[model samples]
Target: MIPDNEDRDDNKVYFFFTEKALEAESNGHAIYARVGRLCVNDVGGQRILVNKFSTFLKARLVCSVPGMNGIDTYFDELEDIFLLHTRDHKNPVIFGLFNTTSNIFRGHAICVYHMSSIRAAFNGPYAHKEGPEYHWSLYEGRVPYPRPGSCASKVNGGRYGTTKDYPDDAIRFARSHPLMYQPIKPAHKKPILVKTDGRYNLKQIAVDRVEAEDGQYDVLFIGTDNGIVLKVITIYNQETESMEEVILEELQIFKDPVPIISMEISSKRQQLYIGSASAVAQVRFHQCDMYGSACADCCLARDPYCAWDGISCSRYYPTGTHAKRRFRRQDVRHGNAAQQCFGQQFVGDALDKTEERLAYGIENNSTLLECTPRSLQAKVIWFVQKGRDGRKEEVKTDDRVVKMDLGLLLLRVRKMDAGTYFCQTVEHGFVHTVRKITLEVVDEERVEEMFHKDYEEDGPHKMPCPVQSSIPHGAKPWYKEFLQLIGYSNFQRVEEYCEKVWCTDKKRKKLKMSPSKWKYANPQEKKLRPKAEHYRLPRHTLDS
Candidate 1:
């Protein structure tokens, strides 16, 4: 329940649901979303009404899109409602997920409403139906005393002690007229998020108010019919006074394609728990490592939970310890990687290493060079550095060679095609080198001969081709010892050595003290008096 300020601290109550429209519109019958409120102090009228609510009010909640000819496409079917509490206790933001019931248009929309706006709507003019024709119009006639839906309390200058003391005219007016003239409009007069795609039919939603570097952001975790939870946030552009919705991640929590029934977010623990019919799952608030370890990738992600921490792409906590308040770079508004990661990019391979591969093909056979980008939205760009002068040229598609989604394919492997290939991705105007590969075309007949010669020189475990690296003359590749340790004989030797070592850890002890310090510490009181003086109860005195 959300807080509603009234005369009493615990006097207000709110109810939300979808029901058939009472008044007929153009259509015969259609469901309309509504929010009704009641006051706890209302005691009904003494004469006209015996026992009923005198301060009950209700108004329509609009969630729709403007269509042609002034007709609005309404998402009238209510699916879920989430109240995101803010620092202001009385007025929490309302997030309502709605679906369109029209057969011609199937879509979902998320409408945001504020408590202040809703309160104002209830206090506006009341809708009245009069005359023989019974046309509904704003009641321009005189309103009854003390207002029809006003609560009787000290807040109104102690006007009326209770609804029982009010006149019969005011009490009867509230019973007959409950609808308000002005309906509550959404924040921006439109849905905050609208989806007309076929793959999505939103079911439930949970929102978390987050504090980031720039400002507070409301992150919404909406569950769908396909068992996927969408993590979305709204970015407000100050210059344009507009809101931009960004879907940061789409997590498939269930594999059975079942509907996600419920979702909960723990801001303290930084986790989201999702539950479906057959399964449940939990995920951390931020998966910083998925953004890649480069400063460019981290900044481009536009995730408020992560930032470039000078050394790596790490979780960014705006309320973290002082040590974490370092000058990390995060640009959520623009994701300007060139401005945020220009000279601050890591220099060594430890933090900024790219994926490398060694691909080989026979003299006449075909070969496929594979590349995988970090994001599905990225555009793959290929380049080749075949020139000896150390210049790179863009790889153009041809009859014998072609570029594909994941990589490039060669129809025929020729010795002249041997060179280093660079696979890069361009996304949001930022370029990143994701993969580097060296293409080698060897003779079909001499393949076995080359393997035999390398085996005799470098041992059978070595790679069939000559190893290439810039390692120091006396040192081997960093993984050489690891490769040697996995042999059959060495594995057994390692296992035998491990058997000689045993764990010395004890089960557990809540608290422990050393024997040497026991003498200096206070002695334990093992034996206590059966009846301590202070523990005895006070005796009662006889009274006359």
Candidate 2:
């Protein structure tokens, strides 16, 4: 049942039903499918109707497959109906799944119908009994003016009112011609999907609109008798005037493999509820984060629930507070997400700190200088900021000086190593300093006194005040020992240098020859004409 809120202001309900009438089938038993309308706004019962539906009207549901004889190819069993609200929200389309009643042509068919067409049929002339044994036929005579089965209370304020005013002939006519003559066909002129294996049949269906990277698409979730749910998508092709139906996935919603009785969808939450005789289960519509770890993989999957943030892949429709995600230009697609997300890139120098970190270390004490690269692809480049020629030179590594794989320089504190050191990252040929450190090695006598002071004192060791500067004496050591112990030293400094340099090497590399355009010396793979000697017709002997 669905309410026609758009047209009737929530006062009307359209119902699809299959019932065995007690009076009509009193002799034996016969079942028929029907569609009817009810005014939910009706409160006090009318005098004639008296608790009965005052505007009650029903019509037959016609579902059939054409046959040569046209004898008994009817499939009157209306298993389920789906009321799909389109984008307009005002108009709703009805889809019915029907199964055969005859034993010979045991099959299923899907049909579509419009609300307006059904209403028009109700307004037309009704069917009437022409002979005994409930023989019903269309009334060829005049429709009796103002017609029977009209919902109006009275005809021009006459004495009779409501359905009670309707004459017996008109009421009986309406009861017989309840069904419309014309029936609607599916969009593809056939059943969207069918099952004839004789083991199971379609039981219920639900439709959901998915907002993908491309656009919105309607997906169908169909339930079957074998405790399975099949998800399908219908793609329309304008040029061929056809629709392509694809089965996206299938899931088993029940543990005991019981038939699925009912199914419903929560569009806003992206959840589908499947019900069986014993239990009910809820399943999420999409698991996008599982597409893959790489950005290209996530983008190429084209899932509606996945998006690639600059650093990692994230779920666009996560549950709870994270569900309301706003779309950005960098959402995953078949395009370059990394390039599209460069707006968040650092423009100025990545290293902004000018004040150098001062450290006091003994001759034999070990220390580590950290330079963490901001990007995974960036290469950390270390160099001595000062030398005899006052020019920057690449730092060399040996047993005394170790370069850790994590972009940290381990040094055995020495007098020669006491100078300003630089750490820069070279990513895509863009060079920027990560940080600068000044290693001021203290004399051995002062270091020994500091150690003695630590062992002998009950309180924290108080180092001699730092060389007269703006820095506090309490921070003289500057976390050098703690920084070396932990590998997160690269993240210690947050700075960016406001400078730029021409990346000639990067430009040259970009303009260099492409491997696809490479040429080889051998050309035997190409189609070659006959050798000059062979094509010469035996050295011109034939011509001579």
Best by lDDT: 1
Candidate 1 per-residue lDDT, tens place, 290-395, comes to 6766788777777788888887878877776666666588887677777888787464213356666556567778888877565545678888888587888898
Per-candidate count of clashing residue pairs (backbone under 3 Å): 0, 8
TM-score of each model, in listed order: 0.70, 0.48
Error of 2 at 431 (Å): 40
Per-residue accuracy of model 2 over 367-436 as CA lDDT, tens digit each? 6664444233346778885555777878888887877644445556777777777887554334556567
Worst 10 contiguous positions by lDDT, candidate 1: 535-544
Model 1's number of clashes is 0
lDDT of 1 at 262: 90
